[model samples]
Target: MTNVLQVIPARQGRAVRLQAGQAIRIVNTHGTQVVDTWCFNAADMGEFMSMEHLHATLGSIFPVRGEPLFTNRRRPILILEEDTSPGRHDTVIAACDVHRYALLGCRDYHDNCTDNLHAALRQIGLRSDECPSPLNLWMNIPVAPDGRITWGEPLSKPGDAVVLRAVMDCVVAMSACPQDMIPINGADCRPVEAHYEVLT
Candidate 1:
């Protein structure tokens, strides 16, 4: 059976602390949901996180079966034991904002991952709230060798999920996509749930 915990950031909620090396599962309870995620060195927040560096060092764009994801500091954070589907997700696209909203022109909806990062920063006491670009978990962002990318149909189904085993004491910041400007959230700002378990 799957374990689940719900989190509602209330339009301005942020900052979640994780015990070092604990396994965490952030679930997209709804389909077409986009999530902005990041992890920091618990002891030294300045070290921050780098998704590109992680991918390069690991030599694979996507997480392998039964592999644990780690921070830039070489610390274990999330281990992907299972992936429901190989949804073309993005690790390069940063969150959007109201100013961006204006730049992109008026849209029907407007909730962004950047806002969630802001909320999380405000909760964590500012210093560690650097808007480090996140890895979009379920949303597909396909990148081509020609340096182009596009948001494609979700590779995950309604009940599809990713399982991660956290390897270090860490702080996780997430935005349960409020994206209406892009194809990622399907023009709907949906909420997601997170769950944790103590593995023996």
Candidate 2:
């Protein structure tokens, strides 16, 4: 059976449930949109994917295809099975929030990934007070040898996709990052929609 494609609308979010051994194929339909992704235990929301633990587990900030995405409990939550992009996902930047926009001189309300995550969860009748750092798919942040980091446009092209297989039953949430203030999404600094499919 074919898995149906679902839209993660630009400047919005979506959430889906997955069983153990299942996978999600996320597509960068427009090539430039950055997807902020998060995974949580289906039975316990507190036990979710942890970037800090994942860094210590992999000994690297960049997670490659075939590596397991670990949880705060230091257990495998999901495995990045395939990636067609340049593998430049960002692991350090916090999801964009209202405060971030304020710092950017936005005096008005802006669509943000942090709010998107929580809203997505609530759509599925779930709730998480804590916003764990997300796996910023396609976000390019280059770290210099001098310990400075520079935000760069994504190197991924249109139709680039990634398959993330769940190691355990989980709920995956995704936000098409609404960061038009920077060029991390693309050279045009415009956010766009992406798509995903849950696979067995």
Candidate 3:
């Protein structure tokens, strides 16, 4: 079968399985979306991609293309093989959740990346006991010299893409972040859809 472009609907999420040596190209289709991305070892759900470990391994908060995304065990789970944007993906922030929205003055239940991640996993008949800190694809958070960090709009343009190759059998989950309370998705704070394709 052809490798078709799959849509991660606006304010929703998706998950896919990949074998070692396979890759997934995630696209910022509209340029205004922040996709919260996570990876889990297919053989062991407890071994998932970890942002804290990633920061320690990369020695930076921003992941560079061609570097491996490390798991909590300090093992490489996926390699960021190719990136078409300016490479400003954030690793410092936690995935947004309902509590975050509540803190933002949202009185009603709000769609969030944390919920999206779990829902996506369930769609594929899998479940995770915890939500790991995701690689905030295209989500820009600028750090200051004094150690303050501020949310910034993404510098990536429409059609920008990143290809992540699996180092071991794994499952990748992505949530098209629904962060309308803030402008992290864009200056307008409008979240939108993204696309991805699995490569053999």
What Cα-based lDDT does every candidate model obtain? Answer: 0.63, 0.96, 0.95
TM-score of 3: 0.98
Q: How far is 167's C-alpha from truth in model 2 (Å)?
A: 0.7
Candidate 3: where are CA atoms >4 Å away?
A: none
Off by over 4 Å in 2: none
- What local lDDT score does residue 198 receive in model 1, on the 0 to 100 scale? 35
Error of 2 at 195 (Å): 0.4
Which candidate tops TM-score?
2
Q: How many pairs collide in each candidate, listed in order?
A: 13, 0, 0
Pairs clashing in candidate 3? none
Tens digits of per-residue lDDT, candidate 2, 17-110, equal 9999999999999899999999999999999999999999999999999999999999999999999999999989999999999999999999
Please provide, for model 3 over 127-153, each residue's C-alpha lDDT reduced to its tens digit, 9 standing for 90 to 100.
Answer: 999999999999989999999989899
- TM-scores for all candidates: the values are 0.79, 0.99, 0.98
- List the candidates ranked by TM-score, beginning with the highest: 2, 3, 1
Ordering by lDDT: 2, 3, 1
Comparison by TM-score, 2 against 3, better one: 2
